[model samples]
Target: MSASKKARAAARLSAVQALYQFDMEGTLMATLLDEFHRHRLGMEIDEEKFEKADVAFFDDIVKGAVARREEIDAVLSQKLASGWSLERLDKTMLQILRAGAYELMARADVPTGAVITEYVDVAHAFFEEREAKFVNGVLDAVAKSVR
Candidate 1:
């Protein structure tokens, strides 16, 4: 991927991580996102470069996903393997599903395939190959439902 695209993808991954933190721990989303930026600055990464990144869509993405979490989880509970409930899902996989489904449902400008592929790729950052496949499958189901 191009650097700009990579940065955007990174932002999405960051957003997903923030969402996971909020969902799993009841953290305030605003505090989490701010903490994310603060920690990134502490890490000495280019704050301006990251801030200038195409992440304006992130808040919408995160908020939409959270707002419809119950609905999204219902979709997931229905579409995943028979034994796989949303609560039983791997954290990264659940985050991937949430991120991709959020874009699929709310961001009509983004190609469904792009959202799915990007999130599946993001899943690779923390999951095994098999986990990416699971993400792919769940997101494919989500894409079909949204379409």
Candidate 2:
């Protein structure tokens, strides 16, 4: 990938983690973002280095996903299978859907395919290919609704 693409991909992944934290802890957005900036983005832990992420992109995804969560969740809920609710989803899975849905709804600059692929790749980090494909299907359904 090109530099910006690489940075954005990293940002998308980190945004999912940040959103997961937000969901579980209800951390104040400002404090959560500040913590990521100071300690997490591209920072090393346990002797492993993270990819350098686009700070602006990271902030936008985290803030936008949370800020527009109700709308995002509505769309996600619609896309889920029958008998499924947003609450039934894994927390990480919910954030992946939220972040991807936010981009599809708001970021016209990003192609639909890129958004789905990026989040699908993000899904792979925490899950098996089976779950990653689940991410793909949900985000694909989400893209169709928004874009």
Tell me, by lDDT, which candidate is best: 2
- lDDT for model 2: 0.94
- Clashes by residue pair, model 2: none
What does the lDDT read for residue 32 in candidate 2?
99
Location of the lowest summed lDDT over 10 successive residues in candidate 1 = 41-50
TM-score of each: 0.85, 0.98
Candidate 2 worst ten-residue window by lDDT: 138-147
How accurate locally, in lDDT, is each candidate? 0.77, 0.94
Cand. 1 TM to true fold: 0.85
How well does model 1 score by local distance difference test?
Answer: 0.77
Expressed as tens digits, the lDDT of each residue in 55-142 for candidate 2 is: 9999999999999999999999999999999898888999999999999998999999999999999998999999899999999998
Which tens-of-lDDT digit does each residue in 11-130 have in candidate 1?
787778778888789888788667776674124465444433345666667778888888888887888887778888777678778878888877888888888888888888888898
Superposed model 1: Cα runs more than 4 Å off: 41-53
After superposition on all C-alphas, the RMSD of every candidate to the true structure, in Å, is 3.1, 0.7
